[model samples]
Target: MNARTADKLATGMFWAGALTVIALLLFLIGYILYHGAKVIDWHFLTSPPTNIAAGGGIGPQIFNSFYLLVLSMLITVPIGLLAGIYMAEYAKNGPLVKIIRTCIETLASLPSIVVGLFGLIIFVNMTGWGYSILAGAFALSVINLPFIVRVTEESITGVQKEYKEGSLALGATKWQTIVKVLLPTAFPGLITGFVISAGRIFGEAAALLYTAGMSSPNLNFSRWLPTYPTSPFNPFRPGETLAVHIWKVNSESLIPDVRAVADGSAAVLIIVVLLFNILARWIGRRMQKRMG
Candidate 1:
């Protein structure tokens, strides 16, 4: 083929592939929303689920999902940030550093089900925490940590070298320059990574199934004390999240409206993930504007 004709053919093929992907994504989202729309409502979101009843809601599961997201992020972000900073700023090129990076990559590539089994052994069996929120959060932290660390390292290193040099030339200490200049400059990317990781927490099931259990006890929303066993704030309590609820309903639930419940739960999970993505973009834009 002529060079010009070959180039045009390749360009057309790439456009076709891109359009196909977009179409498929739109169709998937539309399908889920359509199937679940009839079952989703305020009552469905606020009422507790029933074991064998026809009509039940996912209120506690929703609560557990958010609670676990918050708790896991609380544990994951700080440690990931420190590790990333160390890798980006202080770590030297050596065998140990290479080995550590290899380990992180391996951990990141682990299947969710395998992570669940690891959580079951360490968090549930060894720690004596049973299937509780704390165990789930720690398990999730393991899944999230490598991604966050990589993102943080990349974001910090992506900052312009001039900024660091300028700060240091102005007599700023290494720590001060990092805290003030590097982090703020990388804030947008970091937030994007954080939101993406947080969204994963909502969709996770296998790991949480073993660590957080398949059942959520009746929660006392009125009890604000974290120490209270029945309180939603109590991290020691068993908490089944929305993703787990969906799996349970579809696979083994005895409820008469199992299909409807599963559909609605899946829809809600998709919506929450969409919201997190939207929020990430918005925050990233705002941060970019401020930096500009």
Candidate 2:
């Protein structure tokens, strides 16, 4: 066969694969949205679920999901960034560096279920935290840490060496150069990694199932203190996130509309994740322009 013929065949195959992927994605998304449209309304979103009610909402579970995301990210981002800075900046090629990288890779490769079990053992049992929000957040942080560290290290190291040199030449300290120039330039990438991590956190059920309990008490938004069962600030409380709620409803619910509830919750979760990704991308682009 002629080279031109082979090239055309390869090109056709690539386009065919791309189109197939797009079609599958559209079909899956459409199917979910259509099934969920009748059940997802403001009332469904803002009201708490009822065990006997035909049309129950997922308010508390939704709250728990966002709470988990925030709590986990709060713990993950700073620690990850610091480790990344060390890896990219100060850590020289040596035994310690090798060990650190090895550990990070091992952690990254670990299954989320393993991390969840670890959290269950340490954060839940060892610390007497039980199946609580904090335990779940810790589990998520473990699952997320390696990715954040890798992203941060890459973003920092990817900054052109010349930028650092120029900053140093212009009388900036190494620290100053990293904080002012490198970090700003890397902000977009860091945001991307963080948001993608958040998206994963939102969809996680297995990890949370083993960490955060499948039920939460009626949270009193009025009681903002840590000791109150209803207090949002009480990390020690067990809470069911949206993903876990969906799994629970599908697997164990006796409610007649359990399927509808699960579908609606799943759709909401998917939409939120999608919106988050889109928003992250937009923010990253804006930040990139600003940095430029």
Candidate 3:
């Protein structure tokens, strides 16, 4: 084929692939909404699960999911960002740095179930923290750390070298230049990584099942509070996360309406994830504009 014809064919194929992906995503979303929207209500969202026959709401589970997400992010972001900065700015392509990079890449690719098993062994069995929110958060942080590190490192590395050099020439120290110039420039990408990690942590079920035991929904602030008189240090408190609730309702329940409940929960979970993604993109764009 002539050069112009070849270019046209390549463009056609690229557009075709892109459209196919978009169509597939739309189809999946439409299917979930069609099946799930019927079951969603205030009661469905707020009520606790009842006997397997009567479908109950998932308010507690949703709350637990958010709780875990926030806790994990709190633990993972700072550690990951600092590590990323160290690797990007200070660590040359030396032996120790190469080994650490390899380890991060391998951890990122590891299976979720394997990570779950590890959590079960270390957090549940070894540490005796039982199945509490803290254990679940720890497990999630472990799963999310590699992604955060990789993203932060890449983002920091992408900052313009000239900016760093200029800062140094202006009598700024290495740490000052990094903190003031490089980190701000890379903030958008770092936020993008955080959003991705949040989505993954929200949907996580397996690891949480082991670390955060399966329990009925409860929002007893007195029991959960650290200083409350009734508060017990029960690490084995089976807190039901939203994802696990869906799985249990679908797989273990004999109720005819269980499928509807599961679909509704899945839809809500997807909606929450999409919101996080959109927020991340918006923040990234805003930061980019401000930096420019």
Top TM-score prediction, candidate number: 1
TM-score of 2: 0.96
| Model 2 steric clash total | 1
Which residues of candidate 1, in runs, are more than 4 Å off? 51-53
Measured by lDDT, the strongest candidate is 1
Per-candidate TM vs. native?
Answer: 0.97, 0.96, 0.93
**Judged by lDDT relative to the true structure, which candidate is superior, 1 or 2?**
1
Model 3 stretches with alpha carbons more than 4 Å out: 51-54, 222-224, 227-236, 254-256
Worst 10 residues of 3 by lDDT: 227-236
lDDT of 2 by residue, 1-292 (tens): 9999999999999999999999999998889888988788888897888632764788889999999999999999999999999999999999999999999999999998888889889999999999999999999999999999999999898889999999999999989999998998899989988998899999998889889989998888889888887797799999999999998989987677888998899899889989889988998898889888
Over the stretch 1-292, how does candidate 1's per-residue lDDT look in tens digits?
A: 9999999999999999999999999999999999999889888998998632555899999999999999999999999999999999999999989998998999999998899999999999899989999999999999999999999999999999999999999999999999999999999999999999999999999999899999988888899999988999999889999999898888896788788888898899999999999998899899988987
Point out the higher-scoring one by lDDT: 2 or 3. 2
lDDT of 3: 0.83
Higher-scoring candidate on lDDT, 1 or 3 = 1
